[model samples]
Target: MVSRIDYDRDMVQLHEDIQKSKETPIIRKDRIRKSNNNNTNSVHKETLEENIKNANTLHLDNDIYSVYWTDTIPDHIQESHPYIAIMTSNKPDHLDRLILNLLKNALVDPDRILVFNDGVDPVLPILEKYEMTANQLVQNSQTHTKVKGDQNQKDFYINQHYRFMFSFIFDRLHLENIIVLEDDLVLSSDSMGYFTLLSRLMKYDPSIFCVSAWNDNAYLWNSIPDEPLDHLRFSFKRQNHFGGLGFLINNRTYFNRIEPAWREEGANYKPWDTVVQNSMLPEDSCIYPSVPRSQHSPILSRNYKAITSKENEVDEWSFMQFYNPADFFVDGKYMKVYRMTMAPMLQPEYDFNLDRSIRASVEIDSLYAIGFLTTSPHSSFVFYHRVYSDKDKDWELVTKILSLVGIGNGGVVRTVYEGVIETSVLGKRLYIVGFYSKFVFEKHRATKAKMKLNDLIKLVDYGNAHFNEALTKSYLFMLENDHSLHVKVAEQSESCSTHCKTHNFSCKEPYQILLLNSGFVEYSFTSQKYCKTIKIAENSESELGNLPSLYSATQTCVLPNNPSKISCSYTPAKNENVTRKLCICNK
Candidate 1:
């Protein structure tokens, strides 16, 4: 078995540390067998009688949602459809190497890429030069002749980009569902299988609106809590809006009945949310909630150059597998966590809300950030937090959940949206493909939320597969050097008299502590400033002594003066694991 911890740091972060390092051992692709090809168009295997019985008794409500849905859907559909189209938006002069990094991380087969210019055509030349695969080609009017991403339509451009993309969803592919991507997104290896499964499932269910975990409301009237990537955890059971969702759509039906309203609303509202909102069947309409899940935007994002220094670290799971985003059944043990709401867009501003801030946490076991939502300005977006939960040990909750694979919640959905009563169908049983655990905290990052089983699985998987693999450093090294900490210096003892010379030691003025022999100490350490903490112990001997000193264990610490505990944790790190095991000494 492979060791979970990478004890060799220099080996992992070889490039920067070593002038040149040995090539990473190639893990032959042959070892991992590709699953057999499948046809997603397969007709249902169950008899009409069984289907009716199952739909009514077990798989009841089509509205029961989850955060861990992204993973199961893939297992169910991989035999059928195996590919997803990643529609990446390109930008220029990205100093952070985000574009390159994501391309390396994407689970998408580069051949299936739809490089939307997002209006920046200049990046095309760069993309063309760097893109590795032939299928990874640019898509503009010239390339996608059948689509509306032409050189024109600058007037309604804000909404146009979204409209054109929607039009393209139906225009380009023969597949019933498509997985769209933005350039900045970094996908895991499992994303393709996950999307394909959901797409196949969508083809079977005419009413399933979309299969993503992200939700945002740029065009709504009130504050809607953004859906976490635990795709199974929290869902309107039938509410639709927006977040970066690995959104699965019934393109033909969506375009035919909803496109007109989308067009009209697009004309009125400059934001894409208007068009998406109009796409849903209104309250009076009978066919609207036929599936109960079509949406506008479920996401969060930024352009490469605009906010490029850091990788957009997102929670890894969705509501696909777990019963709740905060609690779930893990390998034999019940895993429970308590996470706060770190951020809420369009709600109480950062100053007003203290509960929802970004903080570091081991929320999930494995996560796959297949997709999230971004915007035209790069300031705002949403996401489809798709997650895949791996159940290593069987527990009662896990067993019970497994027993209900294609089953729905207990009874019929008594609630009606828009007077259209929805029914539970065979596929209505919410098995998932990816996870959807999405929590957005604006400036205050310390107050983040917890995740369910599916989220945990995705998070763990992301770390092993990407960060520890060849083109990178294992997370251990990353945490060791993490400098985004807000530090503080606490004075344990009272100030000494003017002149005494027994236990006094003089600490250099520049350094934080001054221990003078006379006991007169002008002792100081960094105030409440940019600081981060590890599990390591901080002592005067380890910090200020002249002898070769040994460091203590690293642990996450709190600096409360300038920012609260939750508010202090900086932005997330991708495939990013924070270990409270490393220790560093300021020499």
Candidate 2:
């Protein structure tokens, strides 16, 4: 419904473009919803109402834009579980605006806010004016650091500020989690509470390394359905971008793992955000909401002041929906993927023997067990390669099934010989599983001969084989007998088919009637970095039906290397009625 610029621009500019230089909307007492549903303590209702009434009477020009307020401290807040707001800034106005925003909208204790001042501008006056005199504000006016007098120096200063903030939070305060922000950002009404919930989730799951409040895909805000906003938060292995604007960090990971790793590398040449982003554990991800909780207020950031001119851009979506802890789910799909090592590992038989005579018959051999292992319930497929020297002096490689383990603790194995063992207890079956590996080398002929005469060489040979162990042995025991393997296999096959059908459409390639964000169906692709947004007319079902049949079309988008052409025809999804026809084509 809203028109956006073709080029990527700041939110302020978008606001200005829409409003045409109108005065900024002032916060009014009536605009404040008289409810504590916004994660506010009910006791704050009276105090907030009085404050709003007083502000309205004063007719303040730059009133704090808040839709809700509360004075009743939450349990986490009352227990001194204050979230330290670490802000890096040289601009006094920026710092003042950010602190003002926090005071009005954030749910964190104001006393715990920390400011790392990079400029000589006295921020304490600003703090004192905003009733933040007790705030822990520190300054790092380091001018002696050898600067090449370039952008690199500016980048270095940014990292230095962050280093100082992290060190203070890690060693001095010894806090576990912290909310960090750039000075030129404003907090949404629900930001502090949102971060609190995310921090709690981080404590519960160690795999979540960071929690971001800024969404890079905010441009697609219109395409998202607002109804599901309260229920979903995307868990991504890769972030949309470096979230230096607003993010939560686990100080344990920062101090124990990331800081040590950065120092070990001499902390040279890389951006601070990049250092932190790359320092996450191999299997961890940063979780963020589809809708962002913070708005980037600075169009011309201090570091980028050289590139962008000072322009007042209007921001329409500065305020967003309030979210609560009880309505959010953290686990979701990854937009881009990283290494997934959780897949099963398969090893069918032993190797490194000179003789192939020990190989089992086809019926008993584990190689034939691939089918049973892969199709087993709650399992992931793994590929393994094995090499062996045959009696004829030829080397051969074999691919075989190593093991089948269930998701979590459902599948079990008792012995390597019996892949997934199932035992019936009365009428129920139980499963228990374990995976183990050992190295064993082929016996030397001379040692074998000497062992026949003396047992001393046999012990030495055993020691050598034990040291060179080359095979893995797995065992699993059935813990429950209620599940039938045959039924599971059938269900898994059907599930896999459905999953494949649902996710088969490639986002990069031309998709046949692919659903985009929310209910928008992508009927075409114009070989561009971003897709153009269009709206469908309010046509009746009868008018829309056969509309696609009446028209066939092709579109092209210009690329640097070549032009991309997309063809389309009216098509509906499987089992869909005639009114649902849309432009769809596939390569």
Candidate 3:
């Protein structure tokens, strides 16, 4: 809610000011208004943390500036002077209101502007139309990949929304802390004030995360915090803050914690959001609050792209502050941003095949086994119920839970399944242990039919025949249970059989592939069994030392299809003398 000075009256007057300023095409900037000096009206009732941030910052200046813009500027807010950098994206449809509203708010404070083409061609024409200046204008086209039968993959790249948002945050906006905004995002009139307060606050505590704009409530408070910091502050990298419209992150923190993970997840949405919300960090990593100070109410609506002057009466514009809040705040000024304690983790009802089942639909060659539960038939195999990896993901849940045991005791939010362990042995051959496909190219009915006839053949149920060939030669595996599922790799002239290609060995008796089915298999078996199986990553860093692999004891039964009592030392013997060591793959 606004502490109103008559918004309607202000708008009318503003519109009149706009109409009269046609000569300048409606310049919008928070012109340095003379300072508000009534000569110190009252004493400050300073909170402990508040006093800390304020201690370093004396009210050195009191000038205010506001910019008013015409309603026609498109996609991004244009700045009058050079900026740390500019940020805008292709959003042609909302050009009307988005442009104007942005201009109005931006006129508050800004340095420079960076506009993206909104995926449009001939962007300069629009720039010319808006009378905008850009420190840089990034132009590129993005094509969405369409995946059949995959909701997970649908617009999987759409999360590039952050990549688009970050362009300025990285190369352009190099302040100790930076603020990011989206076209359709909403702001609190107090947004600027909050930023100012937070900036000053961070001085004392380098760990205070530049708080975000959205709050999901789940990350609030858990155990009654033990410290007397006064303001209830939670771990920063611990909470689940959703990043869509925007959030502020400290430069140091971004480089240290976020960069690596963001690069790894790269624009995958829901999962990416979950990852961010769950990223792990030490207990002292402070979050002012997890919820964002702003929201994307308009953008969340399907008609978000349609927010233009043609639809709403706003224009494209940006702000230039009397100063970036960075100057006003200190590093450790904690505040009562969050008021509640965190919730305890509740393990779900026991059926562990969730992860196995999620990817089983795509039959993708490899996936991380993120979940597990005890169930019938399978007893206990990994499932996709839920877990976090990719280091940058949200680990607050883990941190908070661990805080219960003791501060800083929490580890990364990952699955503690009976079989998997984070280890050096898998030697970067890290992967999830879940049931994927047993037979490759299931559609080759005749060939597949022949494969099913022999009990020694394994089956992988990837729906796509095209990918099946690659899946068999690649991909890691896990037996679903202790009974040791039987497999029979039939021959090709046995024609077209998945097993006939390169597996040079055939089993005379049904046997199991040593997967995570038996409790006996640990991280090392999983690693040894899945080495060098996946194709080298097409691009990006391909960790050569650990390709996927498969491991199982060469069964006297002729097949290694079951999760039986086979074993490996898990530790690679320090001695170079152990060539015939009980390797998991050769178990």
Candidate 4:
């Protein structure tokens, strides 16, 4: 367990350290100067000092500790290495795990690692053992009390932690670049080497603001398995949004652009990451790997928490298989050079109109089909006419389509491999290509009409034959069944609300009890016809007064059809000579 320290004493020590560092002035090599021009370097140095002074004056929820170093780092090390900044809170166990994983990197330098603690708990001993720098920001008691109840104030404090950390790294330490990591994440063996190679890309490309080690759509259900030869290739794609898990940011970008507009005080608190993302120019973008080099643990924190009362259990076993270092594929040591192509407009080689015969031709690789999308102004759902092509690869065509529909180009486009575009249109999750693709009447054209769901499913089925079998099956199942009626088996002891919540659904009280006949047992819930009548209150025992006995029957919880509801079904054992009672509850 992480032990707590005296907050008052820590604050006093923090104040003394800050004052001492200010009082003692020592001559040091100028590290922040990026340009060779003497006049420009002098002006940049003055601006940096002014920014540091302004940052020190900002209201502090926590005290900032100076970076500790025994000697000046050699010029070669300074030029090639970025200070590794680890942001941590009270989670010592997570911090320990992160440090251990980080140390496993062959290219990692202990002297370059810096821990920025939130000051609730200090792991000074861990830092000492690794010979790493510790910058603990002890919380201010008065500020904490003032921000206790107000959510905006809490967000401000959280945002301020980032401000303080970034300002110290850029303005005070004078580092050119820093790789930021949260304590909850574990780095892959290639993480350091990956960043090292990407750092060159950052220096080479002026338009690229950040390089991230995370693939936003790299979840097991979304990603494709790589072959042995695929491991040798290090592929990266451009994204407008900053993927923040494990990212590298330069001092020039921070001090000049980001720091100036940093939110100091506001009634509505925007997250620091969001502010950074919003501040980027239209030309600026971030580059991230096709496969992630860091894996995030699902431990709850201020930034991440359970959406509902019941904790949703993620399939970590499947997720870990994607992040296994042995399967990382890219040899980071050998992969040093990266050739990044700027925004290249790719015109479709061939475009065909939506039709019934197009499904067979879609199975051919490198085929691009123009699919018509229509949205009912009254509803949140989007309807598609045919198989959707890869949004990112065919962005030029996508832009033209969006222009025709009068929708602007500012919306983020989320891409999943194998010609899939997962997006939320009007608050509803719309899988444009995969299993959820729907047909719509093209009213604007006389020749276009709606296609059957079965036809669309067959297209996806044929197209995804070489893909993961489990994913393909799930996609087919989703397309065949009513999306509103989601059913899953639950423990006999689990409550209706909890069961619904665990499955990412809300629970409505007074669920229905479904009674299934013995002969209909072979059919699934979607196909079987059952007598459902008994209404039971959530979390209460059913009073089967005058009803058939359910002794020796097995119960299964069925999720509601409409957004958040719970329905249950019960089936009797074959050996037990009793009629089976199944209960289903709907909102």
**lDDT of each residue in 410-523, candidate 2, tens digit only:** 011111111111111111111111111112112322232110212212222223232222221000001011122110000111221232234442111122112211111211
TM-score list, all predictions? 0.35, 0.40, 0.33, 0.48
Candidate 2 residue 114 Cα shift, in angstroms, is: 1.2
- The lowest-lDDT stretch of 10 consecutive residues in candidate 2 is 341-350
lDDT tens per residue, model 3, 384-437: 213333232333333231121111112322322221211110111112221111
The Cα local distance difference test for each model comes to 0.28, 0.37, 0.30, 0.42
Over the full model, what C-alpha lDDT does candidate 4 score relative to the true structure?
A: 0.42
TM-score leader? 4
**Over 4 Å off, model 1:** 1-90, 93-103, 125-155, 188-190, 213-238, 263-269, 282-587
Predicted candidate 2, C-alpha RMSD: 24.9
How do all the candidates rank in terms of TM-score, highest first? 4, 2, 1, 3
Q: List, residue by residue over 1-587, the lDDT tens digit for candidate 1.
A: 11113212322343233224322211112222221223211232222123323442112222111112332112232333333444433334431143353344322344444555554435555556665444445355433222355434433454555566666666665545555554434333234433443344333233344544232211111111222233222223233232243444556546654467665623534445445544543211111111112221122343322222322212211111111111323465433332211111101121111111112221222212111101011211112123221221221232121121211111111122211111211112111221211132333233433333343233333333433331112122222232321112221221111011122332111111111100101001112221233122234212211111111223223211110011111122222223111111121
Candidate 3's TM-score reads 0.33
lDDT of 2: 0.37
Q: Assess candidate 1 and give its TM-score to the true structure.
A: 0.35
lDDT of 1: 0.28
